[model samples]
Target: MLICQLSDLHIRPAGQRYQGVADSNRMLGDAVRHVQALDVRPDLVVLTGDLVDHGHPDEYAYARELLAALTIPYLVMPGNHDDRDRLRAAFADHAYLPATGPLHYCIDTYPVRLVALDSTVPGQHHGALDAAGLSWLKATLAQDTVKPTIVMLHHPPFVSGIPYMDAYRFLDAAPLAEVVGAFRNIEAVLCGHVHRPMFRRWAGTVVCACPSTTTEIALRLAPDAKPASFMGPPACMLHRWDPAEGLVSHISYIGDFEGPYDFY
Candidate 1:
């Protein structure tokens, strides 16, 4: 099974730009087209939060319009910038989402099982998994131990070296780590809060953070580095899963570039 992960879209209302600079809406459309044109179409696509610049219904409407171009199945979760109720109302047709509550659910119909967690803290920028969420996760994981599972959440559970980004990092992650670490069947933990692509070995598995489809946060490691972002090449994460070999991931950049030159 091939899973395409698109993160941090930050889509704005039609004709508007994100942060009054990045043409996030257009970029998201391009990213969607890029995924559609993939030689080996992905079996599913997951959007890891920040679906809009603000929690406005107009933004969500435009976002839904932009995403309607996708022909493949997709799932979405809320981020710090999103309003849970508004998001839930926007994607009301997606039955996997609960009628009212944290947008957490498990999809087991495919070869790989997907357990998505809601890590967003409403009206705040930091992330946390409350006791109830952790309990739900523990119970969910206990259901099937044999299936190769992928855990999805908006915030990356580990501290990224970038000081500025780490400021809003996942809080109360110790319990989450303990719960996930106990599950040996989990293939990976996928996240998106950080705009740049990142990977780390965590909780007896791997955490893969997908790059943004729009602006990318500057990779500054200094303790006092000022927060900054750039219009770096947008990209997505392609996770290919095989029962025999497990899951392999790659970064699929969005844009037209010179490539495919024969090396003969």
Candidate 2:
């Protein structure tokens, strides 16, 4: 199964727009075009979150326009910048979107079972999976372990060793980890919202955090610097799942570029 993962567009509504420092809309546009031009069309597109710069109704409205350009099916979850109610009202017809009011969802299609969980904590930069979400996750994992599963969410369940980000990361990973530990079929835990691609392990499964299609978080691997935002190139992830090979995540830069040199 081929999966296209894009996150952290951080778009704003047309009228209530903000500065174009990130030129997020353009980056997202490039991503859409790239996906459309893919040699092998992806079976699914999973957007992990922060769909807007602010969780305004207008912002959601604008976000609605951009995502509608995708030729394949996609699902989005809430992030620190999203308002659950506003997101639902915007994408009322999305099939994989949950009806439970929170922006969490899942799907079993083709050779992969994709689960998108909500880790957003209202009005906060950090993330969490509450009791209800944890229960739902456990049930989902139980029903299908034989099938290759790729769980999607917006927060990293582990520390990236970046001090500021670690502070505002997923606070409760124990429960999630406990359940993840039990399911070996979980090929990967795909996420975003960190705005920089990061990798880690959770309960024996690989966790891949896709970079943002908007601005990126500056690498402050330091212990004292405040969270820094950068003008680094926007990016996304392309995931390929083969029964024999499991899963592989690849990062793609979507804007203008110039490179072909081999470091190897």
Candidate 3:
């Protein structure tokens, strides 16, 4: 099974740019096209969060239009910048999503089980998994311990060294880690929020954070480093799962690059 992960799209209304600078909508469109053109098409695609800039109805509408280009199955969750209610309403046809409360669900139709968690705390820039969410996760993971599973959430459950980004890190990570650590079958914990690709060993498994389709948050480790972002080469993650090899992930960058030269 191949899973494509696209994060932090931050799509804006048609003809508008994110933060009045980055052409996020265009970038997302390019990403969609790139995924479609991949030599080995993915079986599923997961959009971790921040699907839109302001979570407005228009933005979601445009986002849907852009996403409609995808021919493969896909799932989405909310981020801090997203309005849960609006996002739910926008993709109401996605029956997996609950009608109310946190948008958490498990997909068991594929070779790999997917447990998606809603980590966004409405009206805030940080993320947290409430008691109810943690309980749901614990129960969900308990259902099938043998299947290879991937747990996905918007906020990475570890402190990134980048001080500015760490400020908005997952708030309730301790308990969340405890719950995830108990499960040995989990292949990985996938996340978005950070806007740059990052990896860490956490909860007895690897946590992979996908890069955004928009701006790349500046990697500044200084304690007093000012928050900044750059319109760098955008990218997405492709996780290839083989029964024998487990799950191996690779970064697929968007846009044209000089390549295909044979080394002899």
Candidate 4:
């Protein structure tokens, strides 16, 4: 199965730009078109988080229109920038989302089961998996220990070397680790929030944090490095799964570029 992951769209209202520079709406639309034109279309598309710049109704309205261009089915979770009520309401057609509560859910679409966990802390930039979220995850994973499962969340469970982003990393990883460590069927913990693509091995599983579809966060690893972003090549991650090969990810950059010339 081919699963495409798009994160941190940061969509804003029409005529608005993210951070007064990046045209978030246009970037997101371009990313969607890129996927649509792929030779091997993704069976499913997962938008990790940051679907909007602010948790505004108008922002969601615009996002809804932008995502409508997608040909494949898509799933979304909340990020620190999102409002739970507004997100749930915007995508109300998705019955998996709870009418009221954390927007955690389980998808049984393909050979792999998708477990989406909400890691957002309202009104805060940092992330955490509260007791309720942990409980839900444990129960959900226990149901099919042998089935290949992928856990999707907005906050990555491990710290990235980027100091600015690490400061707001997920806080309750110890408890989360214990739960994930016990399940070998969980192939990967897919996430986004750092606005940079990253991969890490944790608790016998892989953790992949996808890059933003708009701008990218600079990869400054210094202890005192300041937070900064740049308008680079927007991209998304495509995860291919097989019973023998497990899961593999490939970065698909958005927009036209130089050709893949022969290397004679």
Which prediction has the highest lDDT against the true structure? Answer: 3
List the candidates ranked by lDDT, beginning with the highest: 3, 1, 4, 2
TM-score of each: 0.99, 0.93, 0.99, 0.98
lDDT by residue (1-264, candidate 1, tens digit) is 999999999999899999999999999999999999999999999999999989999999999999999999999999999999999999999999999889999999999999999999888899999899999999999999889999999999888999988888897788999999998999999999999989999999999999999999999999999999999689999999998999999999999998678874
68-124 per-residue lDDT for model 4 (tens digits): 899799999999999999999999999999998899999986999999998999999
lDDT of 1 at 260: 78
Task: Write the number of the candidate with greater lDDT, choosing between 3 and 4.
Answer: 3
Please provide, for model 3 over 1-264, each residue's C-alpha lDDT reduced to its tens digit, 9 standing for 90 to 100. Answer: 999999999999999999999999999999999999999999999999999989899999999999999999999999999999999999999999999999999999999999999999888999999899999999999999999999999998888989988889897699999999999999999999999999999999999999999999999998999999999679999999999999999999999987778985
Q: List, residue by residue over 1-264, the lDDT tens digit for candidate 2.
A: 888999988887664333456667767778899888888899888888888888888788877788789879888788888887788878888767777656666687578888888888888889988888888999988997788888888889999878888888888899999988898899999888788999987789999999988778888887787877887577778999888888988987876666656875
lDDT against true structure, model 4: 0.92
Candidate 3 clash total?
0
Off by over 4 Å in 4: none
RMSD of 4: 1.0
**Once model 4 is optimally superposed onto the true structure by TM-score, how far is the C-alpha of residue 19 displaced, in angstroms?**
0.8
Which stretches of model 3 miss by more than 4 angstroms? none
Number of the candidate with higher lDDT, 2 or 3: 3
TM-score of 2: 0.93
Better of 2 and 4 by TM-score: 4
